[model samples]
Target: MANPKRYTDDCALGPFSTKSQKTLSYIFSPTLWTPLLFLLMAAPPSPSSVSAELRTSGEEAVPTEVIGTLGGFMTLPLNISVGTEIEHVAWNGPQKTLALASPAGAVIILDKSYQSRLSISSQSYSLNISKLTPKDEGLYRAQINRKNSNITIEERFVLHIYEQLQKPRVTVKHTMSESTSCNLTLVCSVERAEKSVLYSWTWVDTHSFKSFESSTLTISWMPCDPDVAYTCTAKNPVSQSTSSPIHAQQFCADLRASRGRTVGETVVGTLGESVTLSLTVPVSRDIEKVVWMFNTSIISKDWREPAIAGPLMKSKEPGKDRVWVSDQDYTLKISQLKMEDTGPYNAYLCLNTPRLTSTQHFTLRVYRRLKKPEITWIPGPSDDSICRVTLMCSVEDSGDDVTYRWTFLQKGAVASQEGSLLNVSWRSSEYHPNFTCTAMNPISNSSWQFLSGNICPGPSRSMKHWIILFLITVVLLCFGFSGWCIWKQKRQCSAPAFNSSQVEAPADLSGQDASSSEERQFIHSVLLCTETPTGGTTTATE
Candidate 1:
């Protein structure tokens, strides 16, 4: 409904057609002053005039702040109204003109300093400077002109360039402790810093996952809280950097409190027996809750209500049916204790009067009763007068803590020794010749008696007597055989002489030969008894 010609003319001015210009001149020539007035009103104001007016209105040509890092890129923003027609754009800096763009959109470098370093965005007419240095930090101005109009708009930017922030180094100053709390001081610093840098401290509570921040921090370490970690950050206009985290636990090594104290008790019982782990809370405070733990697992919990007269006990698995806690003193009793139960048992008590907690740690040791020991003698040199023996005392399936003790009774005197093996030299005596060996442990003890006679028995007395009798019989038999041999030799020598005389007698004499033979035999026996005649000088009384 409105005339399009007036709308186009009010927004922008472009090259007019020849017919339009001739028609405008003929109409305006009727009044010579009208042509000049129309020309004057159609032209816009000059750039210098517009700039002066903007300055008089207290308008800022440049941005108030711009951040840039050293050796990095930075952009100066420029804003233009929509549907504005631009004829030329120019960028200027402190010492020289930077760039120029013509109405045809051709950009030309005007300064050698920014020949390759300047860029302009077609969308927003923003100027980008690459590889910025500290020397490039200054105010930059952008100027733009409308087509066929003398009016110009200007924008300015103030760039501040700085080096990237370096990582901060954190150091612990010192640690001091008061009566109930500990105070720690720490310092954070950066090397070769030229710009204004801010230091901030941040810490995280590991237990709660909550975070806190401050310019500086001093910790008041408490006994009940877990470890805390803190980090330091150094930030500048250009960049931000963080240091390595440090923990408060590292500084409070010796200040930590003990959780509980250990009380070692040796409980000795026979196999297949029940043992009670006794615990008594002091009468100074009223017991509100009691808990029993085996190793690290909770085995039993006992609690009493405000109006109840007895405590309600709850037992967990693995020890549910076999464990019992007394209501009076809260002592734990284990039925049929096993070897696997030989570990640490803890009892925790909560009191109501002063609201205090007490923990008692018990190192329970369950042992099996020792069986009767056996005493055996190791063989050694022995004689009739004295005997040396080595006796070994031992028990089957015994623990390493068992000890061996030896007791000997010799010649009305008692001597004892403690070891696994005992060496003894025994002499014949009228007193009981025996010794006792005992194997003992904390749980139980057993002893065995060893008879010295059996331990080192001399050669049997009966055996010695039989050996002597056998030797005497052998000697008698040898002597008798020698006498019989001598007598037989003498008989042989005499009888041969008599036979020789008979052999020298005649070959024939039958009837009257008896007296002759007897006479000859008698004569021969006489000759033999005497001596043989020398050279046959027989007394022949013929």
Candidate 2:
């Protein structure tokens, strides 16, 4: 006999016996069948088999939804392997069949609705639809047939087309008065929005950016910063759009409080010095509490009690040890003043009888002390009618805020000038000169002096002395030259000039006295004849 067909739950054929009727009855017994039924009922359904069963049923399978922007391309993915022996492929749309392919691989378009806009990829069997419109949003089915087989694989896709989102608009809903603290509400909305569109709010500050999911945001405190920006964004799965940045200054302009009136004196402090900031409230109001603040930090707070009590002082990290509150007036005293301490300080006094507050603002300025200035003369000295001297005054290790002033003293007359450089002139015997350069800042001042007699002595007198000495030296040289010339003439006269044709012999002093006198006269005559036409010699002498 033919072997009984194997029995399976999925098979629709009649059950076949694996053994004799007696064994089948034993297996079907209550005790055995009950446990089997319980186990079968407890077991989870296989995903693959359930999906296959769903597909095999005539009921339409759920399609995968794809979102796409209008006027854009949409891709419908089909995960199916095209066998080598594929006979034909067909795609069905909501209204009619879209495309069909023959066994010879020639594709034909049955519906000309998307004639040029539809394309198919043979590798992935995915459908590409271009230039999508709102009308294109519908169910699309793809069917693939095997060669000489009745079995066909199918896939369904659901398309959702949407237009690009426009820019959103932000509006302020409510704003309170600027005189008091109040909440501010803002609303963000779009002209047109899809069902899936979501709204988000973003708060942008100088330091950070924060995001919120709600369309409306309420701020408890009035925003004082001009650099902060608020924006709204509308987004969907397919498109996203952002609203224009709204500055806090623009939206919260009416909510800003007026600047507090300045009531205390301006406090000036030197760098690394200690300074006290004081505030006094009017006696008309009952002082219930007092608070002192520096920048954004609280320095002290005093709450009203049954009797007089000291203020509770608090300090932040940087100013902890350096700052404290005094017990007398609740004034704030800061030691070791730093550059960061130069700002506005506030004192708040709360009154109980009238329920009013009085605020005093103090402007604190910290300055560095000026160093001693130095005066130096620039090179290029002049001694024409008046002596012009250029002096540069400067201070070492001085800040940019320091200014220089020059005080010129001439014969007890003082002339003041302000600058880093000074140009002064004086004539001979005109004035005794002295200069003092002062370097000053808001907090301190220092000076340096220069004596003209010490730095630049009497130039005219010195020049005169030099000229006189030069003239004396020239005269001495001329005298020495003249004397030397005269001596040379005398020496020449002592020697006798003889003609080449006549030879002269030496004469004895005792026997030839007359001859010697005659010879001397001849020599003197020769020397006189040898004198130049310039008359350098007045007379000839032996």
Candidate 3:
């Protein structure tokens, strides 16, 4: 049996208080250095100065910090030195004992609540739990000891649980009122407001993009670099997601668009349909990275050059198998699309040969299939041989952004207009017998045909009235034109000419001439329409 004396103890401890004695006691009692060893099992941490200090002092381990995703699995690593044999180990979670290992190298799970989820490794004594929940988050501890030894070695961990981070949005706008300025203000945000999220911005530059450690970034446009692309990443304790790369090549040139959403390609897709975000450019040997990103996640990427293998389809989001990128052209294709798949999608390209970068941005819109359209027509009264009817077109389930168009089915038919209402006008002979109205949206269209004879039968009933109207108008215009010509003829003959000189002529010829010339022609002598002389009832013969 070894003596239980150590310089660390108070009255009960018996030992030489010198440096050698204290060192020997610390070396034997594994509990004294357990904290220092616990840190090694944790996930890698940010760079810190304490690493060197801990190395030199060799006193304590850092508190183990483990982050587990919700509904995921995590293993609390049991970091042990080489050749250290464990007789048995016990695992404890927030509430009570989770599991234990028998000296015979068998795992025995305790806590009935975690019976289905908890498992312990017989050799290393590591604790693993699956399908983690919020209640699983808290402190966890493991105690181990060798056979016939009083010293107990232990490790502690603080477990943090977080759900997947939401997709982030990046809004771009000009900070200045002047439309000419290229200065831009970009803001990055997630759909849900979370406190523990870390945001970083990686933008396209002459070389590989340099990342900024903030949610917002301001930039001064330099004329030399005409095109610039930016991508934002949001990270939680468990996972990280990147935003779609927004190509801002036009943000400076098209100042009018700088104040609203950034300019990018917009694509319309129907729900459950497939769409391919095509990358038209060929892959160059000097290609640095070809990344396909959704709203806040990278669905796929091709990072390897000649040395690297084929494109690694690494997507952590749900329904990841539905997304794929082509090795030949780096085109991204998505199948069985859902609502969450609708967002900004980017195809980012970087080439190291000339130190250049380019990106294509696409905004995907998903819509349900359009419903069937209905056409209703109201016939108006015909006047002066003109037929008029108003046809209103409507869709049953359409809400907004719906457009309407009208087409004439009748050959050589000229009657057609667009809107919710279609105005139809035709002469008695020129009526459009068949017309179709179509209701459409971005994704789908439905058309309804309107047969004029079937819908509006009033054309036959009103046809006689139009024919009579046409005859009456023609008779009145002819009467007016004839009266004007007759009045002008009478005015020219009403003036009489007198000659005072006597003349000699034969008796027979003279009478014939006098009767022919003296009997003046009269157009309407009974009612000399509207002309009255100054003297009353005076008649003169010439």
Measured over all alpha carbons after superposition, the RMSD of each candidate to the real structure, in angstroms, is 15.7, 17.0, 23.4
Clashes of 1: 1
The CA lDDT at 229 in model 3 is 78
How many steric clashes between backbone atoms does each model show?
1, 0, 4
lDDT of 2 by residue, 222-248 (tens): 322123567889987777889988644
Rank the models by TM-score, top first. 2, 1, 3
Q: For candidate 3, write residues 1-542 as lDDT tens digits.
A: 11112222111111112322344466447785786467645744433324422322335434477778888998888765445556777787877777778657788777888889988776667788899998999777666655654345556676777878878898887644442235788899887645578999987577765989999988876322435678899987667888888655345434532233434878777777888878767445466566554533444354543211112233446445666667666777777766666666656565668766566777777776778888888887767556678889888767556899988755543355667887777655554477778888888898888778754334344678989999999999999999998898777545421111111122224335444333333322322432468534424322
Highest-TM-score candidate: 2
Q: Which ten residues in a row have the lowest lDDT in candidate 2?
A: 11-20
Score candidate 3 by lDDT.
0.63
Alpha carbon lDDT of each predicted model:
0.63, 0.64, 0.63
TM-score of 2: 0.45
